[model samples]
Target chain A: MDDATRVEVAASLLEAYRTRQPIEPLVEKYAGLELDDAYAIQQHQVQAWLGEGRVIQGHKVGLTSGAMQRQMGVDQPDYGVLRDDMFYPEDAPVPAGIFLAPRIEPEIAFVLSRDLTGPGVTVAEAAAAVDFVLPALEIIDSRIRDWKITILDTIADNASSGGVMLGSTPTRLSDVDLRLAGCNLYGNGALVATGAGGAVLGSPLLSLAWLANTVGRHGVTLRAGHVVLPGSVTPAQPVRPGDTWTAQFAGIGSVTARFGQETA
Target chain B: MAAHEAGHLLDPGATVGPIDLRTAYAVQAEGLALRLAAGERLVGWKIGYTSAAMRAQMRVDAPNFGPLTDRMLLAGGEPVSTALTQPRVEPEILLILGDDLPGGSDRDRVAHAVGEARGALEVVDSVWRDYRFRLEDNTADGSSAAHAVIGPLLPAGVDLAEVGVTLIGPDGERSEATGAAAFGHPLDALGWLADALAAQGSRLRAGDIVLTGGLTAAVPLPSGARIRADFAGAGEVSVRREAAVPPSRTPADTAETGT
Candidate 1:
């Protein structure tokens, strides 16, 4: 896969993802054509997004959950970049068509003030890198058409990222247990899911370590001012127009997002 | 395609929304309730908390499981078009049981009357609007399983012992580190799944399609590309996507050499 070919493939993948189409097996097929070409396509695509002024806001670690790792047949988790433009204010109504396919989930989002990376990054070191913690709702949407994709395709698709919603309130990392913080989800006034910060790899900070080391091993470093959606505090739920969702954290408080027409 | 078509059990007329609830687990429960409300059958459950690394990554101590309906299964070696749902490609080992492994099944006796094992792909799609999701959200998002693309069945001849097979990527780079990437072997993973299911009073039947997690790391397939996987003796399976229109200003990813 030449650079042009890589870019073409990546562009097509992003388009396919946006339209809910399938592209992983196809991307893998191209993988056999060239290694450098394949990676070039991935980097090129993400960099293009960055170039477009989509501030890289946070990072998402897929297959971070043990169950996901087994199901995907990988030992470690894979990651994708997150951008600031994708962030939604908690309780804001979702604009229609902002994502190829969107779903709602309760997650712990960490605000990092310092850069962290290494071949020897530890959980303790990760904890020190954080600036604050907040309740977050991940509006997960995939660019794939039918939601059918392989893990590698997802990695290239930026982990099926769409947008995130953060609670208005922010708490310092030292103010909460981080791991012991609890979360509960409510949909349309009904309690739907419940979990703790520990559910996301024990602590959102540890998840940061995983991302820092994982990406660092690949020669990528996590920059400061980036937010990390460690993982879902609970399983994800599907959303529709006119639906109101809220995620409540035991200590950190909660955030809410509404959904409606594309412009809403 | 296989006998089943993979799709969201959500009714076409049903309303969708962001499960503003606290956790994705709630969303999953809500979805399951909706499925029950719509009279969709719960075929079986998928296990997500199967890897220690993943469990550690998400800060959990055990694996998690989700329900798989008869609707979620696709034919073996199905060619997924590019215009369908957002799809991710992952190679897996599928298990067909010869007997029902009821709840409380012992790990040692899990090998009894196993029918066949085959390489498979799990096509995961998030029901969210813009493919944005978290691990917990997706996990509760029915493990992000909108459908599945399974492949030709490998006979029971190949067990865990022959798992030293090579995984050749699209770039012609061969990697032999596929061992235990999904818990050593497909059957071993299946065994764990069966035992786990048994504990929930759900048993593996003679015809249940159990996707034994990923065989190799997830590979990205671009439009106009095809993926081919050749097992030592288990045979090979492939899939291709039609050309996709380029995305506006795509990213650049360059892969280097070695290993």
Candidate 2:
């Protein structure tokens, strides 16, 4: 994709989000959306949103799990930025109609106390920067129609992030061995998926470390007071109106996301 | 230099921000000092643009040369370890000196100093945007040198002028040339190199490796490209570029060059 197409695609994706009308996968139109082109398109939209008075909240890592990596045939994971509007109160009901096709995943979220800067940060170094960890439910909604997306499509769509719901408990890294922590996800009073923390790059800390190094090349710093969702520990399951999803970690806390039947 | 090697395109003309050859050499010396500071040893030198057509295209009167350090060598078939701004490969005959070549030596003495000859590939990258610059700019940019990949060494008797070179690209594209492309004979390039260096009060030393000028037009080496160079009667050498990363993503890279 060239300069013109990047700007054009960014505008289309932004319009789709505001209109609650998901557009076709960008890959269909661009046909040759390279990693750099997709990143450029994503940044164009990010800048536009910032101009509209949106605040950047954090970042997200996607395809960290071996299964996702293998499925996508990519050796490393892709990333996206998160904004202040993406976070929602855990106690309030989220409007289902706001998202075109939302899905839910459990993640180990890191809230940083120290800025993590690196093009070469180690997992040990990342461990030193964390303030606390929380159970998080990432409500991934695609601006691309039907969630049919390639890696480029998802990356340009801000890693398909819609909203974030966090658990109340804030535990330190030393308090829990997340690699051994198992998670059970529930939806509408029924079990939907089960996974362990090891599913996300052996441990969520490794994902955090990778995220820092990956973005650091672009001059981005994972700053203090920022939230980082390493990746989903389990495959994302679809969302429906009136559905309620809760993710419970064995040693960590649990986060619940209640959805409205439909927007008025 | 580090930024340029990372595929960062700098200003269009002079890379070192200096225009004169003296300043160009000084700027090059500054970069060499940094390499030495980082514990790299000077191993050899590489000459570029020896072909008549190349010199004409670049509008230069003579071939340019620059120092080759241990850090700039790569093993044959090994992938290029760093991202480069406009990386291209040029095939050459490498001369490993068994004895020093004294200043103003005749072609006989120059030929005698060669211990052996080998087929080699030099991966060249430009620091200036689009390689649009004066010869001084490229000279200061270390003759646009990134890495050298060597092939199997052959005894001193390999044919010089008539030796044929066949280059195959990763996608099976082919380019053909011969040793005569460099000043009608590879040995003349070596002789010119000695005179060029002697002008700067530097003389060839024993164990010094010298890369004669490119045999054919350079070809672009994209991500995962594997380029093979076959030098008739000497040996064959090849190089591969690592799988693609988004531009400007990878950090400092070290190691590549074959025996």
Candidate 3:
């Protein structure tokens, strides 16, 4: 896709975010939307949000799990920028009206101890950079109508990012084995799904390393104090009005997300 | 000279004039030598101007550091002396290092060395009259080092950015802010302190207390008044002022020695 087309596609996605309305998939509309163009489209939206005074709190990696990739029909993982306003507390009920059909997934949130520069960021380097890990539920919502999104379309939609709910407790990297950490997804008093940390590109640390190196090519340095959400352990689960979901990790603490009913 | 006299008589507008940070730190070293000679043992270090609240109140652009000593440590619920000139209190996050901080700008080392994060209130007493001083002069006065009332320890690996602080004044009124007010996160300030100390050929040792600046601008300390700051997820810290003395009023320094 050309620069002009990317800008136009980004504008539509931004409009969707603003109005909470879905639009046609960009991949179908553009047909030639390559990886670079998809990222350019995402950057355009990120810049626009930054212009609106919303801070970049961190970044989130998506499709890290084989289940999610197979579900979304994407072969590789992608990332999205997280804004400060998108964080909801684990103690409170998040308003459902904020999203246009949201899906929640379980992941490990990495809060960095220092700024990480890329290109040669290894698993050990990634491990050292993580100050601690928190159990997190990432509410992934797409701007593409009917949840129809190819990798290019999803990338253009900021990797289908939405709000995030984090647990109050934090576990040290050395204390918990990320590969063996298990999570049980619960919705409304019922077990919905189960997964292990190894589902995320073998280990979540590898996903972190992948993110650091990929964004390093674009001159991005993941700064200290920033939170990075590695991909979900299990596939995404659909959310409904008055739905209460929890992601309970074996060694890590759990985080809850409650969707409030509007009834209008 | 400041140890012998707490207050001074001078023009409030007068500045020591254009002293760089290097000169200021050197002067600070001289002051530290005198304290050490007088039998005070160094305990920790304090970084100032690390928070937007602190920087906005102090009108300084960059952060500065000063040494803390055993004599300046105060336990929780202790009575603060009213003798210090124009004393004010600030809520701060103190990181207790379990290991020696390796030199350089890497924040990973700063986090690894810190065994615990605690909430505390730092009692800052000014030396020159009316708390008036240039940036360099403030440094030489030991960044107004007075006492630290250590409060509660937060859970390990807890996010410092969300550490909400509620400072209850001598009066019933309360001022609120969070750890993010301190340079987005307290650890960032610690990272800066690591680099600053490294430049000075020093490193934070194991068991050292590192105060990561104030979460809020300073509030006045009054006689018989109890001030408490509640840090979310950590706990609360309180200090009571001695009621027997006048609350640091600046009369003409009757015994002024040209300070």
TM-score of each candidate's B chain against the true B chain: 0.66, 0.88, 0.88
lDDT-wise, the better of 1 and 3 is 3
For model 1, residues B1-259, the per-residue Cα lDDT tens digits are 1101353333212333344324555657678777777776766555553443334443444545566676666664455544344555555555667677665555656667466666655655545333454455555667655445566665445444233233334554332222244564455677777766665455677766666665434455556665655543355666555567665442333223222
User: What's candidate 1's DockQ score?
Assistant: 0.02
lDDT of 2 by residue, A9-57 (tens): 9999999988988899888877788999988888999999899999998
Winning model by DockQ: 1
Write the residue-wise lDDT of candidate 3 on A146-184 in tens digits.
Answer: 888888888989999999998989899989767646566
Error of 3 at B177 (Å): 42
lDDT of each: 0.62, 0.81, 0.81
Candidate 1 off by > 4 Å: A17-40, A262-264, B1-259
Ten contiguous residues with the weakest lDDT in model 2 chain A? A190-199
Q: Candidate 3, after superposition: displacement of residue A70 in Å?
A: 3.4
Instruction: Output per-candidate TM-scores for chain A, rounded to 2 decimals.
Output: 0.88, 0.97, 0.97
Each model's DockQ score: 0.02, 0.01, 0.01
